[model samples]
Target chain A: MTTATIIQSLASGLLMGLLYGLVAVGLALIFGLMDVTNFAHGEFLMLAMYMTFFLFAFFAIDPLLAAPLVGAAMFVFGAVAYLLVVRFAMRAKANIGMVQIFTTFGLAILMRGLAQYFFTPDYRSINVSWLGGKTISLGGVFLPVPQLVGALVSLAAFGALYFFIKKTDFGRALEATREDAGAVALVGIDKNKVFALGWGLGGALVGLAGAVMAMFFYIYPDVGASFALIAYVTVALGGFGSVFGAFAGGIIVGLVEASTALILPPSLKSVGIYAVYLLVVFIRPRGLFGSI
Target chain B: MDDAHSKRRLRDLIVAAVLTCIAALVPLFVKDVYVQNIMVLTLMYAALSQAWNILGGYCGQISLGHALYFGLGAYTTVLLFTKFGVLPWFGMLGGGLISAVIAMALGYPTFRLRGHYFVIATIVIAEIGFLLFHNWDWAGAALGIDIPVRGDSWAKFQFTRSKLPYYYFALVFCCVAWLVTWWLENSKWGYWWRAVKDNPEAAESLGVVVFNSKMGAAAVSAFLTAIGGAFYAMFVSYIDPESVMTFQFSLLMALPAVLGGIGTLWGPVLGAVILIPLTELTRSFIGGSGRGVDLILYGTVIVVISLARPEGLIGLFAKRRKEVAR
Candidate 1:
C-alpha cells in the first residue's frame, strides 16, 4: 500500500478508537459504579443515532447541535431506567445476576423492535451541506472533517468528564459510592441520587458518542450490537473499570484492527479483534489496567 | 434406598418409553410432508437444546456460542461427504471430533472468567466464526457449501424418496443426547460441576480440578450439539453460515434451558416441548412472508421469561416450598 493509504488507515483507526473510547468510558463508569452489566448499553447509542438522523433529516438540526439534546434526553432515560428496573432488580437476591443480564437483553430487543417497527429497516443518514465535499489535509494525510470534528468533540468530552469526576463534589461523591456505597451514604451524600447521576452521566456520554458516530456510520437497528461488542472488548482490555485504560485499550484495538485489515482479508478482520479479546482474557484476566 | 430409587426410576422410564414409542409411530400415521418436516425440525431442536443444557444449564457456563460447535459439525461432515464420497454415519465422527476441539479451544480461555465474562467470550467467538465462515471462499463464502445428491442412498445420507429417514435420524440423535445428560447427572463429575458452578473458589479449595471439569462438560456438550448439527445438515440437505451459524441460532439453544429451568435435567426437554412447537407454528405462519415476526415474538418472550421467571416454567413446580406451621 502507498504511504497515503497507510496513513489513512491509521487515521481511521485513531478516529474509531476515539469513538470506542467514548462508549467504553460510559460502560466502564456504569459498570464500575453499579456493578451491573447493562447489556442494553449499546442500544442507548442506537437510540441517539436514530434521534440524530431524524433530527437532521426532519428538523434540520446539525448532529453537533443535536448531541446535547440526545445526551440530556438519555440522561433522563437512564435515571428512570435505574429507578424502574435496576433498583428493584438489585433489591432481589444476589444469585439473580443472570436475571439482570437477561432483563437488559430483553430491553435491548424491545427497543430494537420499537425502532424496527417505527423506523423500518432502512439505511438512514444525515444530509448536511457542510458534510458534503469536506476534506482536510493534515500532516501529509487526508482526514475527513466529520471524523476530525468527532475526535475533537470526544477529546473535549473526556476532558470535561475527567474534571467532573475528579474535581467536583458530585463527581467525588460518585467515586466515593463506587468505592464504598455504604460509606458514601454514611457521609451525608444521597447514595441514590449519586447513582442516578452517575448512570445519567454515563448514558449521556454514550449517547453523545452515538450521535457523533452517526455522522460517519449508517443507522440500523443492529448497528449498536456490533459496536457494543467492540466497546465491551475495549473496556476489558483496558482494565474492566479503569477510565484511562479505556483510552489505551481503544487505541490498541483500533491499531490492531487497522493493521490486521492491512495484512488479512477485510472479512476476517473481526477474527483479529476477537483474538485480542481472547488473548487478553487469558493472559490478563483483569485487563491491562484493571485492578480486579 | 437404592432399591426404592431404582424402582421409581424404572417406572418413570416406562412412562418415557411409552411416550417415545408414540412419537416414533407419528410418521406412520402422518403422510403429509409438512408435518414430517415439522417433526424432523422439532427433534433436531430438541436434541440441540439438550446438548446446550449440558454446558449452559448443568455446568452454568451460559454459552451463547453453542452454534459454533453445531456449525463446525455440520460443515465438517458436509465437507467430508461432498469431497470424498464418505458415508455420513462415519463422517459424523470427524465432525464431532472437530467440533469438540473447537469448543475446547474457545472454552479453555474464557471459562477462567467469572459469570458474564464467559458469556461475552462465547458471543465474541461465535461472531468470529460467523465472519470467517461468511467470508471464506473455500467454504463457498456466504453462498454456502452444498452436498451433491448422487441418487438416493441410505449410506450416502441422502434419501431421495421421503423425510421419514431424516425423522428417525433426528429422533435417535435426541435419544442419544438425553442419555448423555442422564449419564452426566448421575456421575461424580456432575457433582463436581455443580460444586464449581455454585462456587468455583470453594470447589477449587476442595481439590476439584475446576478447569478440567468445565472443559469436560464443554466437550460433551459440544460433541452432542455437533451430532445435532450433523443431523440438521442431512435433514435439510444444505449448510450455510448465514442459515446455521447465526448468533440467534445459539440463543435458540439457550432459550430451551432458560425457559425450562436452567440447571434441571429435563429443562431442555420441557423447553423444546413447549417452545419448539410454538416456534414451528409461528415460522410456518410468518417466515414465508418475510416479516421477521417470529424472531420478534421469540426475542420478546425470552426477555420476559428472563426478567420475570428466570427459574423458568419448571421453577413453579420444582422449587421446594417452606412448610407453614400455623
Candidate 2:
C-alpha cells in the first residue's frame, strides 16, 4: 500500500483501538473476577446503544450525554441479572459452561427479539456537532473531530479505571476477589457482594463504551455482535481476564484489522483476524498476557 | 438374560418399523406442497441434529458451529457438480471428505478448549469461514453460487417437479443417522465417549486416549453433518453464505439436539418433529409480511425451555418412563 493509505489506516486504527480497549476492559474484568463467561454481555452493549439512540432522538442529546445514564441503568441491570439469573444458576450446577451457555444464548435471543419488537429492526444513528463538523489537518493527513474526541474520552476512561483499581478500596476488594475468592471471603469481605459489584462495574463500562460507539457507528440489533466478536478475539489474544492485556490486545487487533482492510479488500480483513486468532491460540493457549 | 433383552429389542424394532412406514406415507395421501416441504425440512433437521449429537450430545462438546461442516459439505458437492460435471451421488462423498478434513483441522486447537471456550472458538471459526466464503472470488462471493438444475436427472440430483423424492431422501438420511446413533450407543467407542463425557480424568486413567477419542467422535460427527449438507444443498438447489453458513443456521441445527435430549438417539428426532412443525406454523401465521411475532414466540420458548426443561422433551419422557418402571 501507499504511504498515505498506510498513514490513514494507522490513524483510524489508533482511534478504533481506543474504543476497543474501552469495550474489552469490561469483558476482562467480569471474566477475571467471576470465572463466568457472560454470553449475553454483548446484548448489554446492544441495549445501551438503543438507549443512546432514544436519548439522542428524543431530546437532541449527544451520545456522550447519554453515557452516564445508560451506564447507571445497566449497572443496576447487571446487579439484577446477577441476583435473578446468575444466583440461581450458581446454586444449581458446577458445570458453569453448560448453565451459562444456554442461559446467555437465550438471554441474547430474548434481548434481540425485544429490541426488534420495540424498535422495529430499523437502523438508528446520532449525529454529534463536535464529532463531525470539522476536520483537523495534521501535516497532509485529515483526521475527523469525532474520532479524535472518541479516542480522548476512551483514553481518559482507561486512565481513570487504572487509577481507581490501583488506588481505591472498592478496587482493592475487586482485585482481591480476582486473585482468590475463597481467600477474600476468609478476610471478611463478602464474595457475593464483590461479584455483584464487579458485574455492575463491567456492565457500566460496556454501556459507556456502547454509547460512545453509537457516535461513530450506527445502532442496530446485530451491531453488538459485530463489535463483540472483535472484543472476544482481542480478549483471547491479549489474555482472558487481564485488563491491561485487553487494552493492548484491542489496539493490536484494531491495527491488524485496519491495516488488512487497507491493503486487501475490506471483506477479507475478517479472514486475517481469524488467522491471527488461530495463530495466537496455537502458540499461546493462555494468551499473550494470560495470568496463567 | 442377554437373549431375552435382544428379543425384547427386536420386538421394539419391529413395532418402530411399522410406525415409521405409516409416518413415511403421510405425504402420499396429502398433496399440499407446504406441508410436504415442512415434513422434508423437519426430517433434514432431524438428520442434521442427530449427526451433531455424536459430539455435542454423547461427548458433551456443545459445539455451536457445527454448521461449518454442514456448509462445507453443501458447497463442496455443489462446486464439484458444477465444475467437474461429476454426478452428485458420488460428488457428495467428496463433500463429506472435505468437511472431515476441516473438522480435524479446527478440532486440534478448538477441542483443546473444552466447554465455553470450545463453544466460542467454534462460533468464531465458523464466522471466519462465513466471511471467507462471502468474499472469496473462487466461490462467487456475495452473489452466491448456483447449481444447474438438470431436470428429472437422478445423476444430477435434480428431480423433475415433485417434492416427494426430497421427502424420501431426507427420511432415509434421518433413518441412517438414527441407525448410526444406535450402533455407537452399543459399541465400545460409544462407551469410551460416555466415559470421556462423564469423567475425562478417570477415563484417561483407565487407558482411554481422551484427545483421540474426542477427535474420532468429532470427525464422525462432522462427516455425518456434511452428508446432511450435501442433501440440503441439493434439496434447496442453491447454496449461499446467508442460507447455509449463517450463525442463525448453526443455532437452528443445535436447537434440535437441545430440545430433544442431547445425548439420546431419539432426542434429535423428537426435537425436530416438534420444533420444525412449530417453526413452520409460526412462519405461516406470524412471520408473514411485517410482523415479528414469530421471533417473539421463538425467543420466549427458548428462554422457557432453557430455564425450565434444560434436559429437553426427550429427557422429560425418559425420566417419566424410568419413574414408572421404578
Report the poorest 10 consecutive residues by lDDT, candidate 2 chain B.
B111-120
True contacts kept of 2: 0.29
Residue pairs that clash (backbone atoms under 3 angstroms), model 1: none
lDDT of 2 by residue, B211-274 (tens): 9888888888899899988898898887888888888778888888886767877878888998
Give the runs in model 2 whose Cα sits over 4 Å from its true position.
A94-96, A138-140, A179-192, B1-19, B289-291
| Candidate 1 Cα outliers beyond 4 Å, as residue runs | A2-4, A91-95, A182-195, B1-15, B26-32, B283-296, B319-326
Query: What is the lDDT for A130 in model 1?
Result: 57
- Estimate candidate 2's alpha-carbon lDDT, on a 0 to 1 scale: 0.81
Give a tens-digit lDDT track for model 1, residues A56-158.
Answer: 8888888888889988988998888777766655654523776777767767776776677678778887756356448888887877888778878789888
TM-score of the second chain, cand. 1: 0.92
Candidate 1 lDDT, tens digit per residue, B245-294? Answer: 88878978887777777777667777787788778887789645545566
